[model samples]
Target: MVGRELYRLLQCPTCNSRDLAVYAEYVLCAGCRNQYPIHKGYIDLMPRQTEFDYISKYVSEEESMGEELDYREMAPPLLAAGVRHRQIRRMLELKPTDIVFDNACGNGRFGLWNADAVGLLVGSDPAVLFADQALAEMELAQADSRRLPFVDGAFDKSLSVDVLEHFPRDVIHDYLVETARVLKVGGRVAIFSNTREMSPIQPIINISKRLGKFFVKQGVYDFEREARRKSDHIKDLKTWDDVEAALVEAGLKPVKVVFWNSVFTSFVEHVLMKLGESLIAKRRTAKAASATVLTDEAVNASAGAQREIVARRAMRRHLTKSSPIYWALYTITLLMELDLWLFGWMRTGPYFVLAEKVEGRYVPAPLPAEE
Candidate 1:
């Protein structure tokens, strides 16, 4: 589909030069000679790799583990009502000529899920292996989500799922600014992630760590490591307000904001998750009903009691190490999460956001006077 007139008529997204030319299967910027590979039928215009936050190694390991523990793949039942997925589906309704950007397109999860709908699907990620995987599966470029190589207003719509929460609050603004720069006027971006309050395990994990060593609690904090690995876990997470403010400051109008996956659904998920884990454990335990015993409430309750005792002793060791601010914030977050889960109002699977790029006069810089 990318041919001579198509190549000639299209300017370098980076340089705005009609001097673009097509090579073996790529479009090159005539001014800079930057080669943008054409995978399948789409051109990748990202410049350098540093634009992504570098998660190749982690994602690789995850992919391997994901295969072994196919349990994670069963989440769509819980996420069928995801607001973010709905938003992406809505974006797919745009005209074929409209450009679309899939940021942090890890393994092209969302891109491939909606590929046939959008016209120009540009997928980018930091990890070479991840990009490699995407290219192998569908088509994606090696580019950073943070610093996309596209020219201003390159895409008519963009979508990022399960990405924003992992970044530090400071980096989020840059992400939003970059998204705004790449999207054309009236372009929309839908982001999906967990709100801080929605996850109760975080505070519990932090508290357990502070007291784990001296208190010697054996298994109470078992889920901590697993919880951190979820895409929503952040070193310094943002509240919903902070996220909204960042989007607004980046010159994108907030159209819709919805939260999903609160503790209610979380409880159900946890139970199913434990069932999955038991399936793993029983395969190794023995040839007897011991696995059944392990699954029973009596055994689980006794274990829970022992854990509480250890936790009580351990917590005593860290009596002075309390953060009132963190506790208050997290508690509120928890309450909100609980409300979402129980009331079923705010507990949408994904926070579906619709944002439009702010349009204004594009004043070109004055040309240099002749010497």
Candidate 2:
């Protein structure tokens, strides 16, 4: 059951009120009279409750993302794609009394990773399909970024990781506004998102790029498949200035901004990390293909996503912390950190921002009804 402390923080995602009633199987907001369901502990508090493609992608039919994996473990940097989970955690400077929100908390993994150290970690996202499997330290909610279910000034800190690229261009400001609204005045938010901009030193990056493609041609990595998947959900890769403007409009002042993926990071993430995950994904996909028969639903549904999930799980299984291979790749990741020290000031993609709620500038907006 969801605890009383969480209930005190609950507000109607639609009306933004604390007049909420906790029931056996659902939470009802008296202000809006909207009942959000809780199935075996997964709470769905999204205002619109519309069908979204994220459900298909993140929640595979064969195996869920966190089904067999330890929820608190971070992916080895070589297979983490570009999340920078360790770096993000360091930047947050979490306090024991802090209550943080894992905004757009994909699978609630980050929250799980940090839950024990903080007062509370509430994860809210469009998809809460994975929350049923979540451990007790964190609370997960199915809520929209543009219209959060929490009341005004509810949290001390927020972390928005790998989420901006997925939001549409038009709603980026709305998302920030909601973020600012939920944070107490002077509360900080750690944001990790990408800009459309590429590095000024593109020629140097292309050196590794060429070698990466050569490896792809030799069947060592699926560069084309990775590119397609990377491009699929990216709706808004706004420039850094646009991001700053959006934050200001939302009443969040940028305290620190760091440009990442400059040189070593570009090579490691785009080339090396892709190679590692693709190789693991390929072998795992092949094994699954040979072992299992597909149902009609599997054929019609997001089969590619399911395969990728299986592959990701295999990568985690093999890259256990005790494995020397994990440490070896981690050393490369440590070297990759040099880019942050050397070239972070330069203009480049996937920036990290620490913004503070400035107070009195943003107005909360209602979520549009499902079309």
Best by lDDT: 2
Inter-residue clash pairs, candidate 1: 51-144, 52-144, 197-333, 215-314, 260-348
After best superposition, candidate 2 residue 290: deviation in angstroms?
3.3
C-alpha local distance difference test of each model: 0.52, 0.69
lDDT of 1 at 16: 51
lDDT of 1: 0.52
TM per prediction: 0.58, 0.81
Report clash pairs, candidate 2.
none
Per-residue accuracy of model 1 over 6-53 as CA lDDT, tens digit each: 342244545455577677878777787777787553456555322344
- Model 1, position 174, has a per-residue lDDT of 67
- What is candidate 2's lDDT per residue for 1-371, written digit by digit as tens? 25666777778877777888889889888887888998554578877544433432333422333332223344544524334666667778899999898888876766777777789888876654343345354687777777788877889999988788766655676778888888999999998888788888878877888877787687665444344334435636457887877677678889898778557865875677766666666665565743431421223224444454445556566676788877877788777777777877888776889999986555644433433
Residue 182 shift from truth in candidate 1, angstroms: 2.1
Those runs of model 1 whose alpha carbons end farther than 4 Å from true positions after fitting are 1-19, 25-27, 34-84, 87-98, 128-137, 198-228, 235-237, 280-350, 361-371
